[model samples]
Target chain A: MHFTSEPRLADGVLEREFTLGEIPGILWTPESASASAPVPLVLLGHPPLGLHKMYPRLVARAQRAAADGFAAATIELPGSGERPRSATADQARADLRRAREAGEPVDEEIVDRLVLPLVDKSVPEWQDALDALLSLPEIEGPVGYSGGVISIGIRLAVVEPRISAAVLFAGTVVPRALFEEARQVTIPLHVLLQWDDEANDRQAALALFDAFGSKEKTLHANMGGHTGVPQFAGDAAARFLARHLK
Target chain B: MHFTSEPRLADGVLEREFTLGEIPGILWTPESASASAPVPLVLLGHPPLGLHKMYPRLVARAQRAAADGFAAATIELPGSGERPRSATADQARADLRRAREAGEPVDEEIVDRLVLPLVDKSVPEWQDALDALLSLPEIEGPVGYSGGVISIGIRLAVVEPRISAAVLFAGTVVPRALFEEARQVTIPLHVLLQWDDEANDRQAALALFDAFGSKEKTLHANMGGHTGVPQFAGDAAARFLARHLK
Candidate 1:
């Protein structure tokens, strides 16, 4: 991991722009954090909207985590943020639109193209970032994951032993294989679902929730579209995270 | 739909090789079927294995449907049977393998490529075939759909008013969007699930089962792999069709 800049944000929170090879990311740390007494870390997974579009939420969530005495972080997903988009990605999007318009099934292979690389490239980058963040004095061992692009969370929860808990947003499309992998996730999970999401498959979300082998998993379903997650839901998720992480 | 050849099979079952546009398919009818008094039809969605590979099961199911007084039929899925494999299909398969090996999510777009065309091309072809078969007066309305390749089953259930009931196999990978489409399905459904399908996402199967808007949808989960549907399960599924079609 390469740290290029470090800028201090509000209330003793420090934001650092860094890169793990080609993947760019940001890490936020609270002022009271130290190596001798490290705080828990929370990794944020941005929604389909690029990181810039989600800056407000990312900042807010990170700030909240920091204020709660935890270090927060996020990484750019493949083809999102400043990452250069590939022909494959563009074609994949066209295919999806065409399939949706035609009311046809998107081929599993095409779906694999869209999600696999992001998961493949993002998880390890996030893990490496975790290593970098944990190397610092302020970030501790136990970790938490939050946000959309749920495949990433599913993977992290399964592979990354340090992640003690996760708060998963249900709006994203989860690949079929992930549901199988989800059975391996044992971390405490708090999943938020928008029951009336125009783009999300409610059954898929519920299936994912059911797929998680986590001993402790809670589903919070609310009425509305993709962005309709209520503040109270977020608060409840935060509390859930606090209980597990803190 | 055009029929090029008709041959008599055992048990007074009649098999006809036909084409809807350029797509090849087969249709079967019982000995008792006649233009004067048509029987109900049952469209079969063959598993990923080619028609030849599934011929025994197809023959058995069609025979059973025939014995139960329903015309049964099946068509080649894209890239299966004698269908010409395209470069896109090969690439999609490679992409799926690469994603799976790397433990990554298949991009949704890529997934669209894999499934959309099959659903788009096949559903209409199936519908056209239905029209032609019904025109013969040997196959009446109130059709039933059975077998795997679930997306086709979903689309048919939602859009085809003629189909009164369906028996859906749960081993196929269903696109997430299909779950939403499934909500529009009001046909009586009997879904067969192999609880331990090695190639299937069990949660996805269950989710699809839950997504069906059918007032009467029954889930039969058996303990086995993709091809592990016991004879009893087939008997049960056949009985389900008999109840609705007969």
Candidate 2:
């Protein structure tokens, strides 16, 4: 892990841009963070939209976490942001987009081809990011994963024992292959679903929630399109994280 | 309305039993309640199982509302509690019970017979009780309806303009007839569903939530049976009331 840019402070939070080998990432910690009293960390996950595209929302969430006395971080996905893109993945994405634009049912094969490889590649990056983040003197354990590519989040919940809880956004395309892995996730989960998201399936989301192995999982479905998650819903998700991490 | 018992203080809340004609009821108000800054009210909704049987839970919810500086109240449903029972309703209830106990699907007519009359007879009584409760010096408007027989809450949310918001418990049997009424409910709603409830149909609950016309509705589904709603879910519902009522 290497710091690629100077750390900056905003609203009492220390934000730093860094890189793990070739992957870019950022971390935000409260001003009170210290070696003696390290804070719990939350990994902010977003759609394959680059970190720059998601900065406004991610930083807002980071600020909220900092306000709640925790640290947050995120890493660029393999084929998103400035990272090198895979031709196969790019082809699958174009095909999926064309199908959706033409009002065609996205083939299960297309979904698997586009999503499975991303999940295969990103879960490790997140785990590696977690490894480096936790090793920081001011960032500690009992970590949580929040937001999407929900397939990655599901895989992390199942394989990454370091993540004790997660707040999953059921707003992304999930491969049928991930359903079994979803059932293997035993960590406490707080899943958010946009009730009328055009790109998402409500029944599939509900079925995934049922498949989770955890005894403490909640589904919060709000009315609106994909981006219209209400402010109170965000607050409630924060409270859920605070309940588990604090 | 006539006060049937002396007012008692518990946890800084004033609790009193009252009667509207033949209907028995209870009211709870915060210590901060006054005519000048009249507290908002929340009408506690529940199954038609009699107040004596539900007092512990009702008073607990009332105290929670009072702690948030809101007055709460409840009235006996017609054909329930110590009130005169209707032979027709009793027969419907028996038939419904036999169907459930025999592991058979409850007929639509049986559901209609059991739920419709109670909804018709009780909605007016609720309005009358609301008329009396809001007339009190310490109670004010921006009221909320919570818990269930969800059909009553649906009707109240539709017909009672005073209720600006509601937190409906989707843990009871909802008749199909209320689907249209559900669509008519335009108030801000926060609905709770016990996803694993044996008596409640999860898909039907989800459909009802979808049919609601409120733009600000949210569905909070937790893993549990009907009576096993977690403490955090209750706290979240209370927070919802505070946001709308206060």
Candidate 3:
């Protein structure tokens, strides 16, 4: 891992930009974090939107996590942001867009093509990032994964031993294989679903929530379309991660 | 209304037993509540399990409400507690138990017979208690209705204009009529569902949640059986009430 810049937010959160191999990412740590007193970490996940476009929301979440005494970080997905795009992934996106424009249901095959490969490639990159992040003296384990591309969160929860908990947003087209993988996840989960989300199927979201094998899973379905999650819901999600990670 | 007792809980909350006409009830207020600075009220609802049976759970909820600077109260359901029982209601309960023992789905008519009359008789009693309770010097308006006998909560949320918010437990046999009434409830709501509740219908609960008209509604589904709602859920409900009631 190599650092490109280290800029502090106005509230004194240290925001560092770095790269692990070809993947670029950013990390935010609270001002209080130090070698003698390490903070728990939360990996912020989002839809395959580019990092520059997602920075505002990511930074806001990072700030909230920092306020709750946890460090937050996120890396670019394989086909997103400045990273080189896969031809197949781009073709899948085009198919998804055409389906939406034609007012047709998204094909399951299209969803699998678009998301499965992303999950296959990104989950390992996240673990690699985790390995480097934990090697730092100022960030500690009992890690948490929050936000979406929930398939990745589900994959990580099933495979990654370091993640103690997760706050998953039920907003994506979950590949069918990931639904099967969800049954292997045992960490505590806090899932957020937008009840009237036009971009996703509500029953599918509920089904994914039910497939989880965790003994302590919570689904918070709030009244809103996609992108309309209320403020209190976010607070509740923060509390959930804090309860498990801390 | 008559106050039969005014003992203080260990935390200094004033617990008063009262009766309106012949319906018995209890009211709990924080020590900080007074005529000069009264607190908002939450009308605690429960199954027709009698006050004697529900006292422990009710008082714990009341104490927590008092701790959050709100007065809490509850009135016995029509055929519950030390109150006189109805033969028709008794028959319905018998049928319900017989079906459960027979491993058959509870008939909707049995549900209606078992719950509708209770709702019809209980809602007005709650309203009357609300009137008399609000007339007290230590209690104020901007009320909240919380806990179960969910059909009653649905009715109260629809009819009672004083209730500014509600935290309804989706753990009852909701009458079909109330599902329609749910769409008329525009107040902010927080509905809790025990996802694996042995005695409740999960799909019915989800359908009812979808029917609620509250634009600011939230559905919190947690892993547990009927009586296994995790402690964090209670805290989350308290926070929801505090957000709207205060």
The local distance difference test score of each candidate is: 0.79, 0.92, 0.93
Please name the candidate that would achieve the greatest lDDT relative to the true structure: 3
- Higher-ranked by DockQ: 1 or 3: 3
Q: What is each candidate's DockQ, to 2 decimals?
A: 0.01, 0.97, 0.97
Predictions ranked by TM-score, top down?
Answer: 2, 3, 1
- lDDT of model 3 at position A179: 94
Quality of model 3 by C-alpha lDDT: 0.93
Q: Please list the residue runs of candidate 2 whose C-alpha ends up more than 4 Å from where it truly belongs after superposition.
A: none
Model 1 misses residue B197 by how many Å? 26
Model 2, span B1-246: residue lDDT tens: 999999999889999999999999999999889999899999999898999999999999999999999999999988889999899889998998999999998898998998999999999999999999999998988898888689999999999899999999997677887998999989999999998998888888999999999989999999889899999999999999999987
State, as a TM-score between 0 and 1, how close model 1 is to the true structure: 0.50
CAPRI tier for the interface of model 3: high
TM for candidate 2 is: 0.99
Clashes of 3: 0
lDDT of 2: 0.92
Model 3: residues with Cα > 4 Å off, grouped in runs: none
